[model samples]
Target chain A: MKSTLLLGTRKGLVVYRHQNGQWAMQDVHFPGVPVSIAYADERNGVWWACLDHGHWGVKLHRSADRGANWEEVTAPAYPEGAEIKPGEPAHTRYLWAMQQGGRRHPDRLWVGTEPGGLFRSDDGGREFQLVESLWNHPSRENNWFGGGRDHAGIHSVVVDPRDENHVYVGVSCAGVFESVDAGKTWAVRNKGLRADFLPDPEAEVGHDPHLLVASPANPDVMWQQNHCGIFRSVDGGRLWTDISEKDGPASFGFAIAVADDDPDQAWVAPAVSDMHRLAIDRSLCVCRTDDGGKSWKTLRHGLPQGHSFDIVYRHALACSGDGLAFGTTTGNLFFSADRGERWQVINNYLPMVHSVLFVE
Target chain B: MPSVNFTYALKRFFPDLREIDLKAESLSDLLAQLEKKHPGLRAYVLDEQGRLRRHVNIFIDGELIADRDALTDPFRPDSEIYIMQALSGG
Candidate 1:
């Protein structure tokens, strides 16, 4: 299998292709100082990335030929009636998450953002239309500015593998939403979720599920890590159950990767504090759940003691057939061939890795 | 014509002048005046063809100029003009 791993780095997109059992980096610099996100379609050799252009604002670029040449394609074109306040960049649109539609809707695309909204692209990555239902939802007016990183921003969006119309999105401040009839509508599927960040912990929405991993094996079963804790939901998000216990680690982070073969096997790189997103105590780490959230084990076969390093950022860790791989803010890339049980530093003394993906 | 302070990065270009009070009515005039006073000043902020380099910015009393390529922004003598290098280091 000719698998290519597309990683969005501090500089730009770094492609790690397995060549002769070792990974080689292909540097692709997109405009803008730092490239926050990238979308690569390995099959068609096309890619797109978002760059931060400073006071001039954010921009998105498209690469049609294996990332050799690129062209600019910013969509919604500064929404009409959108206020362009002084000091604001002209094209102030920041593209957070970019997904090149799956098989069901090959021509479709989806994007999530910092202000917690969704934009869809039907013609690949050229033009976009905002998923206005979520942005104009009842809670969004208050939840959009859900206050901080732990509140209402959007980073993860999952379109149903089998049916592209069915979409589920996770908001930074809000809980999770489900739209079986595509993003045309949404229902806050946060029952059994305790939005402790709110004055009331039992609110239906606004619970802040930072990451939602819909099992590729069984879309019905999914896991999440949020401000409150770790949870698992079956019945297509109709209900959820807290899996975190006081005796164990309280799930707090922006990353969760489920094993491809087994829906029960999963991993979450938890941090010690909420403020320090990557801070870890080294007390216990690499939370691995094997019994479908019934039990979890703190895997630490090759991790360091208080000295090895305990912090892991939300975008740092990603998984594929290469077991599990993650990069640290300290500019170190780690790979664990046997799940999160052990780790080996592959690339050291590099820039802070914002994202890493393992392609077979 | 207004007094413009250069950002730290561009200060070395004008060794003797921390602030330059040039006589000009527009951004282009101020830039040309500075170029006349400090020979290589324009080259640092502007490219070979007089286009503003990506890293340079011109501000009028704190707000950045929207058009960096064609910066002919009007200015009054009393109004302060700020010229600086665009922030790059993260």
Candidate 2:
């Protein structure tokens, strides 16, 4: 059996699949405002989700039998009471990005957080230990806290599937950070990127990348939808290039996704600008760039002609082998079976839909 | 001696009183006084060592004093002691 696509929303998580060739909404859990990321491991048969229990805070939940039953999992406390001292204002720690780690001898799970930190879990999704080296890194505070929302503030941790220790983390206000030696040390990779026209230039973290996807086929390659435009790093984020301009249907929201089968044939979810707000307009269309961004094509057929209220959030876009799909901020779900050439509104009723995933 | 103010969450349990403006001195005294009057208010306030537990957040005149070790948080007479359940998660 294949894994199902799980859509984690502000309300909860919903898993759906094509039944009789129809995308059907399955079981959903309203764990308050669930976080952006959700994991379903077919290898070990474990399904886990980090619920962003807003107003209340954040929590981790696990369902071993694929959405059949769920149980509350507390934050696995450090064995010897964490030595983390309060930073100026207060002791506020929150989890942001989470991934089911690669199957190695030790078996590890990784988690990224706000206030900009990372944690690892060895026992599936059970307990976690703060990656001390990354957290205590001299430049971590500068990379993490220096720029707040200007860089979306600490998210998008991409782990190399071939190697568990080899990691690349994206920090807000901090461009691209890579850790070669497990999670011990991290260095900012902002070579070919340009800093904004600010007093503190690096304030916006050169080229403020919004969404990042490492090419599954070639781990050395990664593409990003930045505040400026789209770029790809063939040498694992060392260098970059501009693939868009101030001309045609360009960017605003960081909505980019790569096809799991063909990494080069990826899609860019278009938005309005670098202003960092979701303003919907019918002109917004998902741009597809084949031949690795040498040229592009805009998919605008069968969609709203003018002033459509469908805005895709940074985390609101997803893709499967069958096709690409995204949910609107106005609670409309649409899916396109033919890559990104066309679309159809599959489900029109959701809680101002945050994101949609077409589970296999 | 100053008094303590219960936040909206604490007020949920102690509906009779609006705030815990007690004449007690220490945190234990104030929470004990609230417990004495409101029965389960102490259980909702402190966990064990009179330390503000995970759920409860004690702010003396808007300053958060959740540190557990020294417990040397001082308050002046009529210092507004606000003890509320700080919802954590999400």
Clashes of 1: 4
Candidate 1: regions farther than 4 A off = A1-3, A42-45, A75-78, A82-93, A147-151, A275-278, A282-284, A308-310, B1-89
What TM-score would you give candidate 2 relative to the actual structure? 0.77
| Candidate 2: regions farther than 4 A off | A1-3, A31-33, A76-86, A89-94, A146-152, A200-207, A276-281, B1-90
TM-scores of chain A across candidates:
0.88, 0.87
lDDT of 2 by residue, B21-75 (tens): 5686676666677677776555344432244555556788889884643356878
- Give one digit per residue, the lDDT tens place, for model 2 in A125-240: 66677677766766654434433342124457788888877888766545778888777888767666655534554453433667677887777878887765787788888887
How well is each residue in A22-63 modelled by candidate 1, as lDDT tens digits?
666666565225666666653355677776444334557778
Docking class of 2: incorrect
Q: In terms of TM-score, how similar is model 1 to the real structure?
A: 0.77
